[model samples]
Target: MPPTPATAIAVDDLVVDRGGQPVLRSVSTRIAAGSVTGLLGPSGSGKTTFIRAVVGTQKVRSGTVEVLGHPAGSKPLRSRVAYVTQDASIYRDLSVKANVAYFAALYGRSRSEAMAAIERVGMGDHAHNLAGNLSGGQKTRTSLACALVIEPEVLVLDEPTVGLDPVIREELWDQFRALAKQGATLLVSSHVMDEADRCDRLLLLREGRFIADDTPADLRAATGTANLEAAFLHLIRELEKAN
Candidate 1:
């Protein structure tokens, strides 16, 4: 019995609706500090909606989301939390270095901090290249560099590795683990099931509901599956039987 890890994020009975349709139903979970947590689900499974709630961007119909000891989206938490969406939130006309520097300036961070962030994301070689001229994966890395410039306590990323090649994806995951080791809590969402094992804990979602919340090993063991994708399918079948 070691000490329980401090909680970085807490969501209680969160419900969200969009276009008159319910997108999240009674979602609740706690994310431990300094850990990499994965939000895994298929597309249109409310993964994005739930992350939006955590980052204080989604309109919740009910419930609460607390981040870094403050209510999600609270002004005080603005600089402590960083979010990168599925689409790159970067200036295509600007060079990679310029984009990182611009975002760092917004957070009152120094240029050296921006450069460090670019290097962390393995985009230092392209730092002087225009973002518009880079590949999709490069653009994603540029967006990540901008987010990291703030040295946020909590990072929420949506499909950060979607377009990346195996080598780049592996490198990015290593960076994520390093960031967690340095006391940053990361909540990363991905539909790629193989990425599940890279996380310390996982929130398995489906159709606006959570199917499981546990470590990847526990999920695999509980479902008697060889891998996360099989485990996910097993859970879905069990859920169908229950319903």
Candidate 2:
């Protein structure tokens, strides 16, 4: 028999609320070690909230979320996990290199390490430019470099490629795949269905709940559709019919 696959992230019956309304309800899923998982949903479908829960930043109403065997928000998981939100987290006045180095310092990483990360994200050419002067995609790439400097075991990205040009978006996805190949578990969230085909595993969400969790090919096969987008719509219809 094959050995059991190692689990990098495990959520058991997780529930969360904000402003007295449920954001995630009894959501449970496991993300495998050394793989890329995509959480696809609409804007208000709890993708960001769910990503926050996995990163241990959001307050949970009840249930357990574990990362690498520790409870979510546990102190040990801090350095091992990295989160890149839609909003770039960088000092506008600082150069791109400076911004990445600042975050590296917080994680006890070296300047050289930061530079390597910057290069990996295709931000090397703009390293000396002030972050405020960079374009939207460039800023996002710099923020990604900061996260990469830590060499996190698990990287959670919220819509990292939403507004990027097709080339840049493809580049980011390539980097994500490379990270997973290097033994890092990555959870990338996006509302766009076109990006669904890039993931090894997909968790489709709607109205704070999962509509389907399967591979792109599997989802298509199950829905008897040749396109991932069509499969998503079929699943949504099925979910609505069930409800």
Candidate 3:
């Protein structure tokens, strides 16, 4: 028999509370190593909260989050994990290249890699432009480039393509697949259900709980729907009937 795939991230009975209200409810799931997993949910559905818990930045009320076999947010994992948050953080006074290169320098990464990441995000032309002069999508690309330059084993991105155009979005998705092919585990969150087909696995969330955890094909097959959005609607209806 072939060896089982390793778990890059494992969450067991994870429960997170904020402002004295429950966010996650005993959530348990395993994200396999070297694969792309999509976290799908709408706004206020706790997607960001779940991501924070995985990154070890958010305090959980119960359960545990393990990444790369160590506790989430451990010192050892810091160098191996990269998180590109929803908000693009960059020095407005610095050029795109400067911003990316600064982060690369922090990890001893060469300038070539920083440039390569910039090209990977289709921002090569804007490399010399100051971050303050860039558009929202450009800033987002710069932030993603900073994370990519590190070449971490696990990358957790929160709404990375929110402001990009269709061509840029498609290009970014292709890059994500390439990274997964190169043995990096990616957890990308998006509220756009059409993007579900691009992921190898999908974790559909609603009200802080997983409504579905399976591949896009399997989800469609099980729900008897034509597309993921339809399948999601079907599942919601089913849940409503069950209540």
Candidate ordering by lDDT (highest first): 1, 3, 2
Over the stretch 30-78, how does candidate 1's per-residue lDDT look in tens digits? 8899999999999999998998999999999999898877889999999
Residues 29-133, candidate 2: write the lDDT tens digits: 888999999999888999999999999999999888888888877999999999998899889999999999999999999999999999988889999999999
Top candidate by lDDT? 1
User: Per-residue error at 5 for model 3, in Å?
Assistant: 6.2
For model 3, residues 1-243, the per-residue Cα lDDT tens digits are 122358899998899989998889889899999899999988988899999988999999999899988889999999899999998988999999999999999889999999999998989999999999999999999999999999999999999999789999999999999999999999999999888899999999999899999999999999998999999999989999999
Clashing pairs in 1: none
Candidate 3 wrongly placed segments (more than 4 Å): 1-5
Question: What's the CA RMSD of model 1 in angstroms?
Answer: 2.4
TM-score of 2: 0.95
Better of 1 and 2 by lDDT: 1
**Cα miss at 203, model 1 (Å)?**
0.4
Between candidates 1 and 2, the TM-score winner: 1
Q: What does the lDDT come to for candidate 3?
A: 0.93
